[model samples]
Target: MKAVRYTLISGMLLLGMVFMKPTVVVSQCAMCSLNAENSTQHGNTQGKGLNNGILFLLGAPFLIGAGIGILWYKKYRTKSPKQTLLSHHS
Candidate 1:
């Protein structure tokens, strides 16, 4: 176990040393404004359509629950306790 731990630590140190080189990248075109191209650009069209379909599927339950809750509130909001009891008795 101790040998394995020492080997792992030394491997990490060696990997770090191997990646420590810094190189400068020179670009000719001047840096443009931050908001130069704010338009939506998806390289894959099918992925966007699939995402919308999945979102609608996931949102269906919440929409149904909201509809049911609204209907329940409208059904119960305007009724009195006596009316509820009378309906249950029938």
Candidate 2:
């Protein structure tokens, strides 16, 4: 069952990666060029900063959830509740 679940998860991840589009990662200064192109009418300075800040803020939850998920998964990957109780009782 574990092996089957792992296989299915791996297959899905592989499929997702294969089908995903190559999107440019707009991090920090890398977004300058993109902002310059679109910042004409809005003016460059405030718009650029706002856009970058918004993107940064938008990414916060995803980052937090991923970190939490890693820790949560690690916590459950080893022993069972019964084993923990038995160890305590012993």
Candidate 3:
């Protein structure tokens, strides 16, 4: 029960952080920055798209990992009485 409550609160905080993020997240390495700057200077939208795409890709893994972690916790949290007793004995 405590774990469930903590998980819910943590999930909500993560979501809030995600949703309230800054608009222009500069996620460029040296080479990437050079490329994006070159493209944007010529009025191409691809640079902006690239930056946003990178941001999205960066966030995807964390979200997936979080989901998998939540699922794993839910699955393993429900121990049978026998299993609980065995663990406690050890």
For 7-79, candidate 3 gives per-residue lDDT tens digits of 9998999999999988766887899889889988999889888888888889989999999999999888866
Q: Order the numbered candidates by TM-score, best leading.
A: 3, 2, 1
Per-model TM-score versus the true fold: 0.36, 0.43, 0.58
- Candidate 1, residue 81: the lDDT equals 41
Pick the winner on TM-score between candidates 1 and 3.
3
List, residue by residue over 1-89, the lDDT tens digit for candidate 2.
Answer: 87699899989998998889566544545576566557756665666666667678878998999899989998878763445666887
Q: Quick one: ranking by lDDT, best first? A: 3, 2, 1
Question: Candidate 2 — worst ten consecutive residues by lDDT sum?
Answer: 21-30
Model 1, range 15-80, lDDT digits (tens) per residue? 997798455322222322112222224343543444456556777998999899989988877643
lDDT of each: 0.59, 0.74, 0.87
Model 3: lDDT equals 0.87
Which candidate wins on lDDT?
A: 3
Candidate 2 has which clashing residue pairs, if any?
A: none
In Å, residue 16's CA in model 3 sits off its true spot by: 4.9
Model 3 deviation from the true structure expressed as Cα RMSD, one decimal place: 6.1
